[model samples]
Target: MSRSIDINKRTELKRLLLTLDVKAIPLWGKMTPRQMVEHLVDQVQWTNGKKTATCDRPAEEAERARQLMIYTDRDIPRNIFLEDLPDEYLYPDMETAINQLMTELDDFDEYFKKPGRIAIHGGFGPMNYDEWLIWHGKHFGHHLMQFALM
Candidate 1:
């Protein structure tokens, strides 16, 4: 299992993002480098209350489901597809996308310093700030490996 995204992990994530070049190709996934960054940005925005997801279950049940998904050592199953993204495309270039994602990461980190409920994750249900950090950290690591950064 991955470490949760605290200040140190957030720094590590930013460093990993910096390692990607504009032309970097995924070793496994369908998204380009820029698109991957965009997807990450969307995730951070969701965590920071800038976006929302409709819950498919009641809050308690959803959180229970999330606990089941996250408490193990297994990698999150591969090739999971997301539906109903907010934009057709978000950033036009890798540099732009990376910059936006960095800003969102900063925002997410700041949000974590306070104790509060985070935005609902589409599949994971309601989350507190710490839970968001764990989920995002795991998700980020998964994508980094998809691009062979891990």
Candidate 2:
């Protein structure tokens, strides 16, 4: 599946996010617009090493999943539930959640500017910056599509 928006394009991302509001309903999945944005914020924090997570899968399996997810053009499947994440929205409003997501994205970019920086993904073991970028692109693209914004 091809991405409808490139997550690396911060300007475009902010523009698209501006169109999303509290009343917006997801085309698929249970998340409200606010919840989804907050989810993205959490993900960006984790990817940037601002938050930590232990690998849930065996090392070998995590590596294989990481390889497939990062190297392939396939889109993340719809309706995949993450039990570790909160079901309720963290922020009081959509605007705040979106702003936090953007801020986290900026931190993610800055954190990865140094060479050899690595972060631990909950299901992907250890990943370098480029791998995390691919994961975030796919992940953010997935949710954007879920809200029919991409």
Candidate 3:
């Protein structure tokens, strides 16, 4: 299980992300700011709704899911697929990218305040909010790292 990110920490994270100067990273492959935003937007929309895409194997696959959940906590690999958005991907520019990120984080923050014991994660079965939080913290943090922002 993961811990949910508190609002304070989330706020600080947003502050940090908003200040990033993406152009500074010279070798983040060919992924443009539009591509990055689009990829991330797709992911957030997927989780918040039903526009599903590739996901880690579900908990029904038990052992593999466990292994991947463990890995999700660690460093995101180089050549991250999110940074390799396809030519067909649609994305807003840098300014809108940052705004959309902020919007989603705020929405998640509000969602966290509602009480529950378990959340049906994409692959990890029903997890308490705290569990989901730890996972989200790592997940979002990894991307922030990818953007050279956190």
Candidate 4:
């Protein structure tokens, strides 16, 4: 079974991220290292309710994807893209982007402290805190691999 890096391991995540620089190129995707950091920041913000996006998939499809992706120990497929997400980088530099991603991760933990809190995911529809954590772990691991950081 494929296992994802634990998103709760902030120190380890930061250490890995610090190894990345703006010049690093992806092995399989279009996003630069800086853009990837910003993308993660955006995703973390969305999951924590700091940003919002509507579910684009049908309810049944979303549920099926949510079940397969969250429950199974499968790694996210390479080069997957969400059409609604921006391709351009958002932060001024890689450092700012990484800092923002870390901040959002911190917020993610705090936001889910409330009981029964849930957030909408574009592809997976509504997700609870645990589901989001698993999703982030997979998502981060995928990107980290894309850049050969893992």
Candidate 5:
């Protein structure tokens, strides 16, 4: 599969963000538009190795989860709340959130280019750049669908 952190994919993600408004409501989830964007920012930070996660399973099980979530074309399970994020990246409006996400996207690109970066996912264990990219894409797509953008 193509890595989801590529320039074209990031552009596509940005394009999707343009469809959202501050007052946009979710179709199937509870996060506000700003909250969803903040959630996405957290995910990107994790993928960029700015944050670390403890393994939630043994290596075998973690690998299985990674393959199922990152390699398959299945939708992420709905209503999953994996972490409690701080309000720092939670902008008060959609426009600001979009800008922060775009900036983080650029940071992710730079981080992914270096060697020996380690991204440790809570459930999926450690991930290389490609695996992290896939997870990030799946994650963003999931939240986008939550707000009826996908």
Candidate 6:
């Protein structure tokens, strides 16, 4: 896994995400496009101080999520999110959802450019800038591939 999520890559992904006519990703289970974008962007906010999550996972479930993502011996699974996501804001239209998501994504891109900020992820524990980037890369990439037009 790459240690950094480049701004250019996020920019390219923004292109893919913006052009998508998709309202939801079917295979990963149903999530309105706004829901999916919101879900991912919240992680950025978690890093940026807009939001925080209690790492309340029990010893067992926490261990499970950790092994699935961090285990060196097995390939990362493509069909599931590392954890549940947020869909708090109900978006009224595709344009609105895409627009907001793009804005948030841009904020994240700019933040990533600075380097060295500590990221306090919801389930992943505290990470330096580099590790945070890898987590988002996998997460956002997963949804991008899922939501690509069929």
Which candidate leads the pack in lDDT?
Answer: 4
> Whole-model Cα lDDT per candidate?
0.73, 0.84, 0.55, 0.86, 0.74, 0.58
Query: Model 2: per-residue lDDT, tens digit, 1-150?
Result: 647356789888988888987788888888877778888898889877689878989999999998888888877888999755576677877778888888899899899888888889988899988788788888888988898887
lDDT of 6 by residue, 1-150 (tens): 422224336456666667776555456556766667667666567755466556666756755665565442333355555665553674666567666666666666566566565555556555555555556666666566556632
TM-score of 2: 0.91
Alpha carbon RMSD to native, model 3: 4.7
What stretches of model 4 exceed 4 Å from their correct place? 84-88
User: Candidate 5 on 13-51: residue-level lDDT in tens?
Assistant: 788887888687788766777778877777777766577
TM-scores, all candidates, are 0.81, 0.91, 0.61, 0.91, 0.84, 0.64
Model 2 residue 76 distance off true place after TM-score fit, in angstroms = 0.8
Give Cα distance to truth, residue 111, candidate 2, Å.
1.4
Give residue 66's lDDT in candidate 3 (0 to 100). Answer: 45
lDDT for 143 in candidate 6 is: 64
Per-residue C-alpha lDDT of model 1 across residues 57-113, encoded as one tens digit per residue:
777787777887666545666777765444456776776787788888788777767
Considering TM-score, where higher is better, how would the candidates rank from best to worst? Answer: 4, 2, 5, 1, 6, 3
Residue by residue across 77-137, what tens digits does model 4's lDDT show?
A: 8877764446666787787788888899999999999999899988899999998888998
Please give the lDDT score for candidate 5.
Answer: 0.74
